[model samples]
Target: MSAKITLIAMQVCGVLFISNSAFGQATPQDASVNQGTSASQDAELEVLTVEGRALSLYQGNGAVFATRTNSDIDKIPQTVQIITQELIEDQAAYEISDLFRSMSGVSYLNYGIVKMRGFEQESQVFYDGIKGDPFRTFTIPQLFNIEQVQTLKGPSGAAYGAGEAGGAINYVTKKPTFEQENTAELRLGNKGFFSGSIESSGPVNEDSSQRYRVGVYSSTEDSYRNNVEEDNLILDLGYAWDFSNDSTLTVQYTHFDQLGERLRGVPIDENGNFLTDISWNSNEPDDEQDFQSDIFQVNLEHSFNDWLSSNSTVRYYDTEEVIKFHQARALVDNDDDGVYDEITRRYQDQTRIYQGIDLASYLVADLGEHTVVAGADYHFASEDEVFYYANGVNNGVSNLSLTNPSYDSDISAYNATLNRDRLTELDQIGVYIQDQWQATAKLNVLAGARLDYFSEDYIDNEDNADNTSYNDLGYSVRLGATYDLNAQIKPYTSFSTGLTPQTASDQEDSLDGELFDPEEAQQFEVGVRSYLLDNILNLNAAIYHIDRKNTISADEDGNTSAIGKVRSQGFEVDALMDITPRWVASINYTYTDVEADDISEDNTVYRILANNPYHQVGVWTRYEFPAISSSIAFGAEYVGERTDRTTSYDAPFTIQPYTIYDLSWQTAVQDWKLQLNIKNLFDKEFALAGFNEVSGAIVGERRRIYLQASYDF
Candidate 1:
């Protein structure tokens, strides 16, 4: 260890010994265990290590349910993927935005939006099963307070009421624990990185029945460009009362505000292929601008009993953005190709608002050897988005021709591009109920359904498309069965459905309205899960095939269309093992095949979104020195190459895989402990993301470093 690292470790040890007098502490297991290629036997089992990676958490059991996941991939009755908090720490994810780049079965676009299963993320997120859309102008998922992030695949309209045709992401917030808990973190690295946060959770009463938790995070950093920068602030508060009885109530609040430069995407040449390698339009003078958002939300949960509970929520948000992009493709074109004739510049300004409430409850009952569970919920939501654009018209001296300014320059051209606007608004309501029944000691059956009503309208002055309104009544049904394969294992099978409402349906050849269908998906899946080796090990695996119709996507005509045909098939496995005292590890893998109707179609090719990868794999592990415990963690993880993408009508952009290594150590001295981290140890560069509209892609980051000191109060 370096001199700096040695000193930090000494300080960390000092604080740990000092703090022990104050108090003590803290998983989903099924999700962590199921990823192994073969969970075939009791002898090969062990607890896994996937913590703080996604929505997964480290439960009191020390089992890494790391994804807040279940034992069987089929447990959720839908496609799912989780990145654990452990994985995030291993990869040195400073901003939650950086986490998406290395995850499999998912990809990022622009800045923070994620695309899953061949479709862009449109409607799949839920927090403990509640609505949480980061795409909205007002809401942003703050990572410092996040426990895990859960992604539910396919249309969620059935359960979430109204949803995107694509999918969604839910960021589970960290909650308070019975034991008094406190932690502090500091990170500094590439591109002028710096971040710090402090959190504490403990009892509010002597009996330790009531508890409170609070956290705050702040960071100021610059972008890849010399002139661009970012600054962020986040605050979170939470409380819960156990009353040491049957009833419990919990409430939590969070806030986020950020300001940063607008980074426009690189442009493409006449052929629509990448024209310049990795170039910024202009870090020029008078070309600077900023974007910002303020977000706030509150949630309440009350439990009537072990078998029943209900939840409610309230939220508000605001945002603004200003950005500039130089048509590098146009500026480089020496030929008078028509590609540079019709479009020059693109600019937009937007405003949005959202508000909602939810009420739901569940019941669990037992009869004979049967366990039956039933639940229902209702939600009301409203949202709006408005955008204004200015076409590039003021560059003057325009022949608008990419050809060098020649004798024809005297001919005046339109001084500026067109000025236009666009806006979208929606109102929605939903209700649903589900039940699980055990018919025999060896067999279990699950069934459920949901109903939703949604109304939406959009107006685009740019295209003179106004008040285009759409509405729908949608429903979904699901069925599945579980059977104990033996003393330590169970295998299961499930079938479920989902939907979404989109005006593009009116333009479909079938024009299947609500009566005909809202959109459809029927998934067939089978998997197995086991807890063996004295509860120290767990394993799970599953495979699935999905048949979907009424899928919303744009067609070759540049007109929106619900293809009524799209398919995704994949397999996944997760595993974790407490192989031995102090040594822990976890792994997860997914492979998907996407087939869409627009694959071979002309103009619709790009609109169909065919460029995303098909295969994904992730693995991570850590070990603590048993002798010192504080000897600390050593870890690494990898995201495999992508072979299939649904972009440009199936034109593929296969990305090679890359792995990341991370290390950390902490020890306490007399009054405090110090810590240090090194991320992306090898500085591997891999594809982070890209859009079909352009032939270019986003690249991941290089090496980063940080060191910190903490002293307990």
Candidate 2:
């Protein structure tokens, strides 16, 4: 650890201890005065009430990224889902995948890939409305410092340029608050897992114009599989200043460090069955993976007058990673004994750096019965990447038998043969504009458009030769309308377009040095939002159809072309209700149908898309007992069967469906709280993902338990 980080940790610990001791001895008069003053201040601020917080799990009133303004959810003509801090705490979530239980039509695949609406969302992740590279390190961002997560379905290309057709996910970080709050927590779980964290936030000045917040977290754990372990540390800090002109400036910084051993899946047998009998990891004990990152951002908001306001944001990100592991490459049957004989291993190394900036300004005006909003945005990004690979035989390691494996082989030969090296550089820029109008008392309209330009450069570092350079320009647009039938119900419809630029690697694979055109997609959607029983019950439903063109494919003659097309259609529904004053429940379901046309042969189509489930359902409920200040929650998730096709054998296979259950209990006493969570209640064995060629499969985690205790000052 660095000296600066060590000093900060010591200071935070000392402050937490001193604050707890001082707050424990308050007199009755002081306590009463403090309560009265806090209530008065809360009335002047837009604080979230207990009921409002509870209702956020099912529906949120407003979101900034959904419309680039503080517009009500019912007024937006798209499907959006918000996952709040309360839900994160109740589920004891540590990673992004754990929070997907509250959403429908989304799937978490291997290597942290999230799929939505039958499309992969590998490059469509955002933080505070700014884009971030999700595949940079192959690890999802930790959820310890996040306030909420929002998902906007369908194409948002008109607002954010250069992305996939699967939509986008934005993570909102915790900000400094005027009210004083501090907390300390400790967690213990199975497999020698232990974690601790401290959080503090409050005003730094008497006038409450300046505020500060800080959080520190550290954890260590051993995995269920052999030779796998992990350690991690994270630090976050924030400051906000409210100027005399009624404007605000906020700055934030975060650092993360993680080290662990990579886990490789077991190879499949000849009969296309997962090797469940394997009790040890395939990689050697010396294999390791390390990651480190630093992030900084600044945000400014100013109001020129009552009818016009402007906001801008800037961010910088730096990340470093190192990986060394033995990967399974191929399975061969050397002997005719009906069993796999040899397993080959490969080694790889990669490094990448990413930096980006986004600037946007907005104007709001009112003329007659119409409310008009206009905006313009500009974005720029640069990335550099390098990769190297080595085979097992050249590295001094020998292939092993399937039934009997040995780890005594040396890796010195492998380290000496790492000669291949490649480099790639990418740059992008975009501009956009949007407007929203209230046509009448019960009608609303929205329209937007964007233009983008991007370029890519590639080179072979070892050979000192340039490969290729590619560039392209693209445009997108969106239009929507909504009608309010009553105070509790609204119906809407929209049409949107999306575009994705091809990379240098994609172009290099084409025949005769011909570059492929960018992929394009269009979608049509209809939805309804309703609330009943005095805003205690919330319901939402949506149906959508998408058509994608110019997808790349390979022909039997070994030539690549952009003559592919795909169609996807789906329906989703969600409901959340406060059954009484003490009980809460939420339910979500989705049905998807996806098909692709034949690119290798004429007049042929696939029945299903790989790794995409046709049906999904999730349910969660919580009940509280005020007498004991305790609450218990129950949840269940179901994933339907999916299909995968093998190209070499021209055959199809199926992955069976499965369901998992979870339970949580929480209790509070005085200034302390305790919680217990159990996952995979039935200890069922299942596969999270697999390949149709019978190469390997990823096995889901087994039953585990976690217990945590926290104190508030």
Q: Which candidate should be chosen as best, given lDDT against the real structure?
A: 2
Residue-level lDDT tens digits of model 2 in 1-713: 24434544564576576674633321112110111111232246543333422474445567878778777777788888888777888888887878776878786565566668877777778888887542354676788888888988888888787787878888998898777777778788998777778887778888879988899888777777656777778899999999866689999998888777656555554333565444445667677778788888888888777777777777777777767777677776788776666677776665555555666556655454444556655555555555556766766556755566676656666654445456566666777777777887678898888888888777666665447789999998989988888757889999998898887777877887777999898889999987777667778899999887787777777678887887888999888888877788888998888877745542123222666788989888888887998999998889888654333435455566779999999998987789999988897766565553434555666777899988777
lDDT by residue for model 1 over 230-319, one digit each (tens)? Answer: 666677788888754765567777666565544544334322343443333322222333444444455555546654544555544444
Give the TM-score comparing model 1 with the true structure, all chains together: 0.76
Could you list the CA RMSD of all candidates, in the order they appear?
7.8, 5.3
